[model samples]
Target: MTATAVAASVPVARGYRFELVKLWSQRRVRLLLLTCWAGPALFVAAVSQQSTLPVDTLFGRWMHATGWAGPLVTLGFAGTWALPLLTSVVAGDVFAAEDRLGTWRHLLLAVRSPRRIFAAKVLASLTVIMLLVAGLAAGSTAGGLLTVGNHPLVGLDGHPLAPADAAGTVLLAWICVLAPTLALAAIGLLGSVALGRSPMGLLLPVLVALGLQLAQMMPLPVPVRVALPGYAFIAWNGLFTSPAQLGPLLIGITVSLVWAVTAAGLAYRIFLRRDFTDQAYDGAGRRALTSGLLPLAGVLVVTIAVIVPVTGGPSSGIEQDKVQRSVATAFAHLYRLQTEQLHRPAVTEVQLDTSAACTRGGGRLEPQGPGNDWRCVVSWHLPGVPAAGSATYQLDLTPDGRFMADGDGPKEVNGYFLVRTPAGDAPNPLWQFDGTVALLPTVPKG
Candidate 1:
């Protein structure tokens, strides 16, 4: 047989495109896509009104507030349930669906090469995941275009990134954030291959994803945290800061890719070797679950052992930031001090803005009405302790609560403070009922 003839006779497998066509023909996948498209927008609308959308940046052109949906989709919520569940909705079921419908045998016989067929399976799954992520970004951008009109975007970092750069950066962040989540999809697909029953594959990854997130949140050391794929995902947030960096993000992407490919290989091997297993577990046409469960359990146990520590120990850079507050007010004074020993900053026109923290909990601080210019921050079930700006400390009551003590330094002295809310015209300030103090040092101790 000539090369061309052999190729023609063997049939060039086009990979995911064929898989995508098969998936698209299914009503479930299509409904999944539609739900993905509409879901985020609706959620954002429910949480926030369309009119009050803040412009993406300071230099940003006047646009509608519903425009917030664009960036909001790129924020934490979108990454949490929206994208992972969306990917899982397909990936979790991709392999198992055929089994449920009794088409696995016909499909396997159609492709002939299990490796090629597995590759196509993976390709289609990834394509679906990628499209859903891209669609989230695109749909919101289009909605923004329709609702507010396309204008230049400013990045989370106040630097004036080009509109394209800003859009691309947000999109890239969303994709990179998927590093940890992809492993869920990969392992789920592996379950699909090995278990032969679709539900067996789908059910496990959802449980694992949810379980792992909880496990990963424990106080662990940095190296331990860095080892887990989940650690890399949240840590990639370093890219959003003023000086954008990708070191951890690059590391994250590398780790996710490694795990995913390895899982893909394992899944392929399972599909290839599945027929040789004992026939006692099922009748002639069905695949067995016993083989799948052990590997799944082993991986789960080992990963949980490693990752639970990673989650339970001291946080990595990002997790530490997320776990703790930066601008805490502590009350400390020099051991001995005279009346004249205390002196506040020469020019103490400090403006403390706790708006970001309050805004985090869906509570808006009005600029000029009752509760206007108030500083209240979200502490319950928040993603991160909001960084407070515009806070200034002038005095510290001595430990004995007798004389006032002022540490000598610049107004932005790098230390902690415990503050007593002096009366301000802005309205009632929520205090600790005692005093709230945190470890917010302007400069980190060496």
Candidate 2:
């Protein structure tokens, strides 16, 4: 067929199929899928045989107790860098590979329109990304179940979830991560089109993710932090709580959509306008980098300017009221478990009438906001005891509203580091616990 006839006959779907075939034929893409599927299983098996648990990660402490914990723990760890790096490997290289091979001119001639080619590449990249995530989630869950057995899961709110319910929640948590992962992929796509170099394209999105992570650690305004794509990675924490906090999840979805649309739209515009002539490719590196970076920098500056003026408060989204409530609720639920372990009478959260008074820096600073020095004095009523029982806890909080709290309490109840149970000594459910407060403002119950 003639070049003109071929270009005229080719549809977006045909181009999309060509891109998909190209991706599937690459060894790196196949290797990525294999690693995603097998890596978690191996890690879970290794960890199961170890003497120590990954207590630092959310749900890590419960890995041995429940199969569902493995995927959630893996999810937490992956959010840090794995997700971004995995997506970037494909999205970042898809377009740049054409540049490297000097095939863009031929591909464009065949496809006729850069717009159609861009759409095809994007669709193919996104499809592969989704598959990668699904493989990760499935592999983690399968590994956990095989190694640990399907036991009851201790949730973030200190409630026990049935195996079936825990499985559903774990899957849902993975689903929630898709929005931000896709946004990062879109950013990677932008880098690929802009830099027209595989190395820079692959690393740019990962670097951006790292920068956003560091920014989240800073005391940026609550709105500003929530608006960042990085925040959506940890937004799944809310799903593990009882009466799950949907505020952060909702905000994360919205923010991720905005980022994906903005970055992808910019990439589309740039791709459509680029010259693919053999001569134009000779001295295009400097021009391409300048054109790509300048618009992105401008967009970021305008976004920050708009966001900062509207939400300038220094509050870290880790508000005192929300933290106190989250801690108190988790404490009540765990205390009941402790009581059950002791063969004591059953108790409910409401009957405990739990309340916590929290402060930071020994009251030198306000109780609200994120800090390492947060301390809370929790008081609750026991059924037969005349005096109210109290325990002190030291909390280290992150800007995204997740905190690790260590109880300073009576050794008999809290038990040094491990709590005594019928199954010998196990990690204390209350001695140290992790919990997340809804970052968005919530309505007080009447």
Candidate 3:
């Protein structure tokens, strides 16, 4: 490279090293890293000793059944608040702390350019965030294997995943989550630069995350919810299903990138224009607000434009046929587990020839959308039994295509919440099952 280029790159490299050293010296950053490495394992150990399981979270009920469930369950819980908090604590405070310490002026007067300093801080913060995520993933995997044992994991689609497949899926799920976590870190950086206060910078990104989560739970349009930042966190659910739904995953990555770039770019603009010499200077006036809002508005418009083409078509809603197929397949797999627990001959899902008829709100509404009032009657055949058996299930579904189905079959078979096994009374897989439905259209099976 030319001499000028080499000279220019030196400042960024030096600034990056300096920023890393600054982060390493902080007590809170060191403590947070340690916690990330140990917290999930500790949680798994505690859960293993308890009789009650966290059945609400995905893979929660299977914590004791498979070592793989520990990381997955922890991932589900982390998406709500832990991830946002983890990213914000560092990125939010990194820039603003310099202001509080009155070190910004000295840093600006140094040989490093403001742009190079900004780049260095961003790189350092992202590196730290990646480490924290890796720590959590490794810790949870180790904890689960040690405490729960490496048993086969039951997939969301009711199929049993071998140990190797389960491990790969768990790893992939964590990797998928990294995109949104980085996006949240970018938001924290934006808050830190704009607010110029350590406390607000740390808290603002977390509050924004909380708000997005609340909006997700509300009854909003499918396209709108998909466009939100929080959707990326839960989109990893698709990974645990058979065939692995990639549509939501793709959309999530796109949405997160848009937010991250927009936030970081605005922060860069503000940092470049601010008069650092003035101690009383603040970046919170009408002009600043307008500048920020205009870019955000444009971002939203672009996001919608991209999302509508992918998710706006008429075939985007829930399909009854798909739901019935998913319910039937899940029931068949769980029924085989139930039979095995009873010491009966195990039946394969195909041999059972399972089929289901589902309806919403007592048949008053179309069973094509998200609602809690859905019901299905699943019927299947068993070898040596002339008469076919049937069971009724109540399904509570969410906008994001996840559902919990409660079966009303005979207690001696699949109705009881718990089934007795040689190990002890474990959760009856057939009693209540969780599964996901693809929102996008798929080719019909013959």
Query: Candidates' TM-scores?
Result: 0.59, 0.92, 0.92
Q: Write the per-residue lDDT of candidate 3 for residues 1-446, one digit (tens) a residue.
A: 10111244447778889899999999989998999999989988789667888888888889878889999988887888788998888888888888788887678656337778789999999889888888888888899999989999999988889999998988988988887887788888887887776376679779978988888776565677777866778888888777788898878877888788888898888777766776765544555456565776677667766777677563435779989988987888888888887788888877899999999999999778788899999999999899999899999887777889987777755688888987798778888889988775666556
Winning candidate number (lDDT): 3
Which ranking of candidates, highest lDDT first? 3, 2, 1
Task: Indicate the residue-level lDDT of 375 in model 1.
Answer: 32
RMSD, each candidate, Å? 13.0, 2.9, 3.3
Flag regions of model 3 displaced more than 4 Å. 1-10, 312-316, 420-426
Q: Give me the runs in candidate 2 sitting further than 4 Å from their true place.
A: 1-7, 279-314
Give the distance in Å from residue 399's predicted Cα in candidate 3 to where it truly belongs: 1.9
What residue pairs clash in candidate 2, if any at all? none
Off by over 4 Å in 1: 1-17, 42-69, 73-75, 144-165, 276-446
Q: Residue-wise lDDT of candidate 2 within 185-233, one digit each (tens)? A: 8889888887775487878789989988898788777767776777779
lDDT of 1 at 205: 68
Top TM-score model: 3
Worst 10 residues of 3 by lDDT: 1-10
Write down the lDDT that model 2 would get.
0.81
